[model samples]
Target: MEDKKKILLVDDEESITRTLKLFLDRRGGFEVRTENRGSQAVRVARDFRPDLIVLDVVMPDSDGGAIAQDLGEDPELQSIPIIFLTAIIKEQEIGGHGKAIGGGVHTYLAKPVEPDVLISHIQERLGV
Candidate 1:
């Protein structure tokens, strides 16, 4: 049997993290870990070593961009892909390719995104 992929979800909203973690857990094929505090994201990621990270842009304690920067700077964590989930921009702003921000290097999904769409993105990013 193949090993399940690891995913880290970083969001300030407890409900959002909980809901997403439940949904992904129920779906199977992946092991998910969530961090509600952005300030603790890097620490958790270092310990969990997830293959992918689903991050939120705005958080009261820490900025997602800063976290991403920190991850990118870390040699151990730099290879992991990140998908930004944000309400700051509408779905239309993402364009057809869903690579609106980060100069086409990163994936950004608008808030209120469908579960299937999120799953598809996750699979596509992970090549699963």
Candidate 2:
């Protein structure tokens, strides 16, 4: 069987992380890990080495953009794709295809996103 893709979910809300993890786990094709603290995201990512990251934009400790920048600056983690899962924008703003907010390169998905939609985006990002 083909290996499952590894995914790291970085969100400050434990509930969000847990729910998303459960959804991803049940959906199959992915090996999922969750980190509820934004400050710990980079450390966890370094250790877990996920193929992709679903990150929350707002956090009490660290900002998602800063984390993404850190990951991008790191030679070892630079290649990993990141999808910003945020509530700052409405789903309609995504306009069919996800967009890069603030002119950044990473894709952004509005909050309350459907699990199936998230899964499809993950598959698209991973080329699965």
Candidate 3:
């Protein structure tokens, strides 16, 4: 066996993190670490060095799209793929998320997401 794919989940809500953490870690073969604030995501990522990140698009101080840009710009963190999760985004607003942060993330997932769906995306993206 090898090291599990580390994942950092950033959300401002505790329930979402708790719920998703269980699914992503147990079934997805991932070591899931979570942050309940958007502002803390970058710092946590620096320390966690997760293979993949699931970020909440709408947060208290900052949004996931902005966080992704910050990570994408850094040479050390750029290669780590991010999946944006949002509740309010309409179908038409999906593609332009890249433009908001001036760059594109690996994938975007909607909020109230099913456990299996999120797990599937994680497996597919991290190849776990």
Candidate 4:
């Protein structure tokens, strides 16, 4: 039997996290855990050991990019793929260290993301 895929989803907004978690848990075919603080993301990711992390780039405490950088720097969590969810990106221009989507993100999904699209991206990135 295959192992169940675990996904850690972080967003500062309670409503967004709650709604996303419900849809993700119901149909996303993975164990999804939602965290509402960016500062705690690394700790949760370290403990949860999720195969993928759905990160929000605009949290008030700590931006997702900083969390991503920390996760990338940590050997235990570096291999986990990160997908940035945000509303800050209103343009299509790409720029970053690797220069993709205007910053350091594996993929960017704009705010008000549909449940199906979110699940699809999770499946695609996580190979679930």
The number of the candidate with the highest lDDT is 2
For residues 2-121, write the lDDT of model 2, one tens digit per residue: 778999999989999998999899884589999988999989999999999999989999999889888887888888888889889877886535544334467778888888988988
lDDT of 1 by residue, 1-128 (tens): 88889999999998999999898888846799999999999999999999899999899999888888888788898878888899898878875134433222567888887877888888988888
Off by over 4 Å in 3: 90-102
lDDT of each: 0.84, 0.86, 0.81, 0.79
Model 3: colliding residue pairs: none
What's model 4's lDDT at 125?
82
Better of 2 and 3 by lDDT: 2
Give the better candidate number (1 or 2) by TM-score: 1
Kindly indicate the candidate among 1 and 3 with the higher TM-score. 1
Off by over 4 Å in 2: 96-104
What TM-score does prediction 4 earn? 0.87
What is the lDDT, from 0 to 100, of the residue 47 in candidate 4?
A: 92
TM-score per candidate:
0.91, 0.90, 0.88, 0.87
Local error of candidate 1 at residue 100 (angstroms): 9.8
Q: In candidate 1, residue 98 scores what lDDT?
A: 48
How large is the C-alpha RMSD of every model relative to the true structure? 2.2, 2.2, 2.5, 3.3
Worst 10 residues of 4 by lDDT: 94-103
